[model samples]
Target chain A: MVALSPDLTGLRTPALRRFLTPGLVALLVLASLWSLSSGAAGLGPGQLLAALTGDGLSARDEVVLYQIRLPRLAMGIAVGAALAVSGALLQGLFRNPLADPGIVGVGAGAGLGAVLAIVLGGLLPAGVLAVTGSHLVPLAAAFGGWVTTLLLYRIATAGGQTRVTTLLLAGIALAALAGAATGVLVYLADDRQLRDLTFWGMGSLAGATWGKLAAALPLIALVLLMMPFLARALNTLALGEAQAAHMGIDVQRMKRRAILSAAAATGAAVAVSGGIGFVGIVVPHLLRQADGPDHRRLLPRAALLGAALLVLADLLSRSIVAPAELPIGIITALLGAPVFLWILLSQPSAARG
Target chain B: MLQIDDLKVTLGGRDILHGISLQVRPGEVVAICGPNGAGKSTLLRAALGEVPAQGRVTLNGQDLRQGKPQALARLRAVLPQDTQAAFPFTVAEIVAMGQDAGDFAPEPGLVRRALAEVGLDHLADASIQTLSGGERQRAHLARALAQVWQPVGPQGARWLFLDEPVASLDLGHQLFVMRLMRRYADAGGGVVAVMHDLNLTAMFADRIAFVIGGRIAACGPPDAVLDPGLLERAYGCRIAMNTAPASGPWFVPQAAQAG
Candidate 1:
């Protein structure tokens, strides 16, 4: 269906795009507050605001707010945004709407690496294996993510070009391999290591700290800053490699940069949050439906929508069981899958392929 | 302004184009006509550097051997057959992509004018994916038009390489695209198009090249190159040619009677 043109004169000069940004920003603000205030401590909105502003709160409340909820909320937002942006980039690169970092094995690869680190930690000295103190696990996870990305890239490319079907197939194969590796590590873990691995695999923001946030923030910021400039190039590329080359895109260079950025962002997110699923795949599709498929707009909108979705998911994960918490990954899968199915079913048959 | 010398292309251990040579001056429309698998598309791809080939291609006397991608893109634009609206770009955005590599800033008015030339201006804001095949072809032509550059040093003429530019188009759109190419040539641009429709080639091509089995069998004006002998030899099944009142010859394929 054709989009109706917005009136471009007078007050609507910036048009529908202006309205969407503020609306999404407001939703994100509300979701962030809900994430912070709706947990076990259950501070009211006013107290939450007071704790945030350092206005009127006791020492215990201050510690809980600053040391716990704030970091968790920040991690949720950053990881969610990173995953969504990476998904948008991959979808553009593959020219397939179904593409996501998780589907491409980046998340599973990172998860496998982190599980391996945990399993191997028992063999090392206690001083070297301190889980929270050492950056070794994240480093290993990032390496695993990048290696898997390279493998997928090579398999997908043939005759100096990439094909979407080949890329998807390669991604599925690697994802299965990583999953099997993760399963073996889980099977072999001791009681304590198994507990740690299970909790991490369930996808928590509970481990968020200033140090972890510091590690992830710069990478996310760099990707976000660079990805919008590539929107026009990606749009051209969707026409196919031949046309994109004719348009002077240097299609191979563009694909390399896009894939590298996607891997880095996805790896960083997995390192911080531990295998959060569905946000990457669903957020971009939802935003594309709402705002149409201009990646310039879609990228930023997906970032915001993703952050909001994760914060909302986190809220439900904490509150649905009251004293007991559901795993955030379970919550996202339950919610995101139905929405994704609805979108797919709603599209006409011609548009689906 | 554009010359190809002894061009040869090999792909997948198979030689697809063998020692083909031709030239097109400014304001000339050269149509390469051939049957299926006769290397017409291969020749156009070779010219655009989309496929590897052994040859010398000179644009206004500048050697295009090992030409940098950016330089080639600035000097020529290609429209291949079987274009799909694979993305959701607006028509205007797709057209603007043609100017992405060049030094010249694209004028929006030029985009509108190009779309108008193909009678697609009203759909400029529409999503490209929603267009029909004919409309999408016109949009591609508009994109090529936007890429047309006047060399700053006065050394080269812009060339458009089209492979089956009008295949699968309705009669009107077929005529429209060919006429647009003719007008582009008349404006001092060079055009080398691969066409399957011999009638259209006869009507508009300044010269015709008939290719058979990866080789150019004949190259000359339509009247000289499209005679019965070449037609029967290249196609293996053809009958008669009729001269049109204003255009040129029209070939009718005859069914062989069972013995």
Candidate 2:
């Protein structure tokens, strides 16, 4: 029972429908080119093509193009794709368009782990330190994400069914808990440690490397590949859980897989990229508003848009404050917050939920 | 046939249903009517295995809890009171979701036929989120109809559990849904509805089960269960009962008589 709103026609106008798949891919290519050209080392298309073909290029150009920009670009694509797809999966799971990775404590959980590693890494055993070495922070962050996800999911689910509302509320409470823990860890950090913590909290791809990408790529790819199988199930889930079950979806199994996949994707992305916020929420929300909420179209398109947005944002982070990069997270937040407010203002009913 | 035997449900550590028992047979519509918070919806949920409960619910002599979700989906469909599909799915797309749980592959014509039966054939391309509440309810009914479109299953008889299916509809659409359910029953399917409108229940239901305090206080044919005393006791209000010239029985709440 709802009072009729004035906008009786749907939100999918022709303008909104213009960027489904092909449009997004085309934009992604242009953005990627722009990113490749504008880095600290200005490697134009000729140099990029030379690097690609293993043609005539100086060793410095080779290092910048292959070691630095390429890895960062690759990491951006993986992290962006992961976060956006995870958000779409979550929104579908919750049966609410506003659901995001942060709603489920993944971002906070990863932040807490990173802070702990930064503040407490010296106190850890030598064998553990030796084994992880420079990779200790990302490893801890990923593990923290996994633990928090499992805990939140366990607390919210009873028997086989996951309560979407409960998961959301629990996530909020868990995020607060993780935040307090992160704050305590930050308080204990030295000046240099605090600086590292702040930069990591804000998020960056500055730490990108072939090794980190290699480690995280499999997890991100597996989660993305697993998502299409869930498209129909998630579509049915748009109706409430009971109807989903009544329609013959193993509602419990679907919920489990969705949560796990989202967690895995978010964990991998956060581990590699630090705290890149808003891509998850902003990309999917914008896509759903533009196109209809068909997960079949929504998920893949969100992935493409998310990858492009993050890649472009990463470029801005480096170029906006040249020689001293702004954190990618800050760029995304600056861009995303206004769009989020506009969406809420326009769709007041969706905002209430 | 669908049978509920000694089904007890407790929510938030409070008993909501106490050993409720009922049977729904093919070719008949059984209406469960009760006052607010009388466990009418809870009974329907328990019957559909959407909620946890004690005791046994069986469809065609097979225990409902033991059946796989896919297997049970083929045998029955449920239409809940809240038809809030959050996504902006087209009516045709929403209707097609009915086939997701079925054993057989999707039949495109079934979606169209189900939409037509609910008088929403013209709005098949419209977004479900843009439709009025009543229209959404009809679309959900159409979804349920499309789910059990075969009308008969390899098992015994297909069952439909509707919780206030027509609560949001106008008079014409309400009758349209009722007739559709009637025809569904006529086609050898069983339907159990949680109802509120006494007149519609009297007109449409083959049998009435008056629920009170989480139990079936009375159940029988329309005339047999239409007594004002039973309704008054169940609803805690005075009720005026009347028989229509053409229809069978109708009832409305009366102002409290001075003690």
For lDDT, the strongest prediction is 2
* Top TM-score model: 1
Q: Model 1: per-residue lDDT, tens digit, B1-259?
A: 8889999999899999998888889888999998899998888888667788999888777665456556767777888886665446678777777756554454547778778888899988777766788788889888887787442224457888888889868999899989989888888888899998999999999999889999999999999999988888888886589988888799898898212
lDDT of 2 by residue, A161-225 (tens): 45555777888998999999988888889999988776566578998899878867777887878
* Candidate 2 off by > 4 Å: A1-19, A52-54, A117-139, A147-173, A186-202, A346-353, B12-14, B103-105, B236-245, B252-259
lDDT of 1 at A304: 92
Instruction: TM-score for candidate 2, please give it.
Output: 0.88
